[model samples]
Target: MKIVTKRDRVSLRRRVDQGTEEQRAIVQSILDDVKANGDKAVLAYTEKFDAVQLEDYKVTKEEMEDAFASVDGEFVEILEEAAANIRSFHQKQSSQSWFDTSEDGTVLGQKITPLEAAGVYVPGGTAAYPSSVFMNVIPAQVAGVERVVMVTPPGKDGKVPDGVLLAAHILGVADVYKVGGAQAIAALAYGTETVPAVDKITGPGNVFVALAKREVFGDVDIDMIAGPSEIAVLADDTAKAHEVAADLLSQAEHDARSSSVLVTTSQALAENVQTEVEDQLKSLPREDIARRSVEDYGMIIVCDTWEEAIETVNEIAPEHLEVITADPIQELGKIKHAGAIFLGPYSSEPVGDYFAGPNHVLPTNGTARFSSPLNVDDFVKKSSVISYSAQALQKNVDKIARFARLEGLEAHARAVETRKERWK
Candidate 1:
């Protein structure tokens, strides 16, 4: 990990927004092809990029049953428990339609409507992330969306992972597809012959997938333009160096661009953590990827005071923040920006990633400054409900006309004026 003082903050911010124009162009081409050719283009790209060819792109019922039987009974029980926790947490986020009525005959309210359909993208290749299946699906289901579609890349043999398939079956997601990358995103945005168009798309993906989502934002609602995984640890002299090092590396191992940072009041603890991270990285299986991440993006910023450390954390607005101080709870109040916060030594970031009810899909980079995590609200739209009775319209007629005409909107003014005339 690179050790530095708080003065390097400006340069670090620039480094986080780095981009590649060539990658964007490639993703655009794939998106264009999918939009024009539909399922034919999707299959061609799947064969070209994933090295798998397929006639039919949808997962069959037999495949879902096979996935269930392949996994052990113990694993199924654990996933069911996790699903229950996720569902319960999201259910609390569900809201009801409300109306406010007045004796004067004005009815003002909000009506919440779940999206008609939603598409979830799951990255599939060598590794399988069944947890993602649970995290993305349950919230949409809780929001009362009717059709939840899933799209994942197929392996060399052209089959989705057992765990991914099992997770879908457990959630009762019937519409699963065998295509991925930019093509899948395009298919979801605009209807393909096989994959139906969706109102929204949510999940983390590679750079190509991110670019595809960015290109199709207006065509369909999306969660966020996700960046690399990142975690920031705020600690003081009282915090243990080994635990701090472990937490930093947990995010670093995700990818070479993933950022892991430590801001501390004590120079001694910073030095100890730097050494501990190096020691731990030597044994990790993804050492090459983690090492590059640590060398390039990992940082340990030593500050002169707790106030300075907290200020630095807010500037970064990291995706995940962990506070390991003598009073972690007290430190949380001082933090104003972060996607998800893990307080104290026992409340590590992984707790929120897996078992905890909070959604794992969060704003990345510095987007936590303005955005939020994926929840039930992401799957629903709210409409304002307003009805004016004759008495109400008669009372407010002149004011409505004056306001609308003042803005040069004669049509708007006439609509209210005509109703008011009938009332009078």
Candidate 2:
């Protein structure tokens, strides 16, 4: 990681968007094919990309049972514990339908209802993250979604990883499918023969998968167009150099473009961290990916004071922000933009990523400035409920008509007038 001053913060903040025009075109073609051809197209793409041919796309109950049985009992217990923590944290976010009434007999309310079905995408290939499965599916389930359909790419032998399947089984998600990539997203957007259409799609994926989510957005609701992983460590002289280095490398190993930055008040600490990151990188199993990410995108900005460092963090709006200052709690209010904030040295990024109660499905590419982490709210919809009695209409119809006329919406004005006459 390169050490620099606060002056370079602006130039270093901009990250290249991963999906290109070519990727968008390819994802669009896949989406169109799935929309037109349905199951046949999904199967063809699954075979072509995943190198697997599947006669049955959906995982059967027997297969799920087998997956559960295959997992070690100890790991299954750990997953259950993690699921409980996640469920407990999100249950607090649940919303209830509420109504209000006025003296003139006007009733207004918001009816909160969970979507009937939701689709969750889990990437396949080298790694299988049961934590991600728990993070995405549990929130939807807690929101009262009737069905949570999960789609993942199958291996060359046409099988989903046992760990992924076990996590689904633990969550009671029975409608898991053996398909992935842009094709799976398309299937969810427009219902295939076997896969049912969903109310929304939520999960992380590669560039093609991200582009596919972008293409099918209107057809189905998506959580967000996920970018590469990123983390920012806002530390002072009091923070440990080794601990800070480890936290930065955690996100760095995620992807080549994944950014790991440090904004500190002490130049001495910054120099120490820069050397520590390189020393730790030599032993990492994913050294090549982490090295590329740290060398290209990683940075250390030495600020004059803590205020400047905090300001820089808000400007960048990283997905994960760790504040390891003297009193981390004092800096909490100053952190205006971050998908998730980890405080103190013990609160590392992985805690939230796996065992912690928070959802790991967060906004990226500086979207934390506006967007939020995936929660129960993402799986539900709200409708404004309104009702007016004759007394209410008599009191307000003329004012409503006048406002409608101002907008040149004659039909709207007449609608109010007609109601007012009836009230009279």
Candidate 3:
């Protein structure tokens, strides 16, 4: 970690990775093949990329039972508790159909409808993330979606990870598929012979998956195109050096492009955390990845005041923000941008990632400025309802026609005019 005393030297923005033309071309070919050939293309790509041939891609009930049996009792208990917390949190975000009736016999409101089906893509190329199963599937279930499908690549042995299966089983999501990469995304976007197409897709994946989602966005809705992970800690003199260093490293180990930054008013705290990060990096299991991340993107920015520190954090718009100041609560309202905020020393970043109720699928790469975390709302659609009474139409018809004609939309003006005479 590099420590800087000058405020002008701090920069945390990372370049978003939009895959190369070659990669884009490859993803497009796979999407087209899956769109045209459906199941056959998916199977061929699975054999080529995942190195496995499967006559059937769906995970059977027998396989689910085997996976459930493989997981220990204690881990199952933890997954249940996490699922309960996630369900409770997302249930609050669910909305109902609402209509506001006016005295003039006009009705207007919004109708909330859950999608018929939703797909969750879990990554299994490098490591299996059981937590992602809980984060993605639980929200869709809470939104009252009729069907929730999960897709994950099979291992070289042609079996999904036991932990991923256990998590889906606990959530009661039985439609699990043993496929991944852009091919799985295409299968989800366009219905295959076996895999069902979904109204929306959510979850994080590699560059190929991201590009696939981008290409099929118009035909079906998708969560934001996520980038690498990021964490920004705002601390003060009262904050402990070791705890802050540990929190920063939690995100640094996620990927080589991951960024961990600290902005503080205490010069001593900044210098201490810098040394502590270097010391702790020696012991991390993912030391090589974490070391490269910290070496290239990590920073310890020393600001002259708390205001400067807070402003710097807002500018970065990190995916995760930890406030470990003397008064974390007082600084909460000042934070205008962050996908998720973890306050105090005890609320480490990992708590939100796994056990805590908040959704871990958050916006990254400064997108927190405009986007938001995955929630029950992502699985549902909103339709605006309008019911115009005869009295209301008669009152506003001329105004509407004049406004439409002003825009040079003669047909729109006539459409309103024709309705006015019928109502009159």
Task: Identify the candidate with maximal lDDT.
Answer: 3
lDDT of 1 by residue, 272-350 (tens): 9999999999999999999999898899998887899999999889999999999998988889899999999998898
Better of 1 and 3 by TM-score: 3
- lDDT by residue (306-355, candidate 2, tens digit) is 78888899988999999998899999999999999999999999999988
In angstroms, give how far residue 33 of model 2 lies from its true place. 1.3
User: In candidate 1, residue 297 scores what lDDT?
Assistant: 88
Model 1 CA deviation exceeding 4 Å by range = 8-10, 13-21
In model 3, which range of ten residues has the least summed lDDT?
6-15
| Candidate 3's TM-score | 0.97
Q: Residue 295 deviation, candidate 2, in Å? A: 0.5
Worst 10 residues of 2 by lDDT: 8-17
Ranking by TM-score: 2, 3, 1
Clashes of each: 0, 0, 0
Which lDDT values do the candidates have, in the order given?
A: 0.91, 0.91, 0.92
Against the true structure, candidate 2 reaches a TM-score of: 0.98
Q: Model 3 misses residue 37 by how many Å?
A: 1.5
User: Candidate 3 local accuracy as lDDT?
Assistant: 0.92
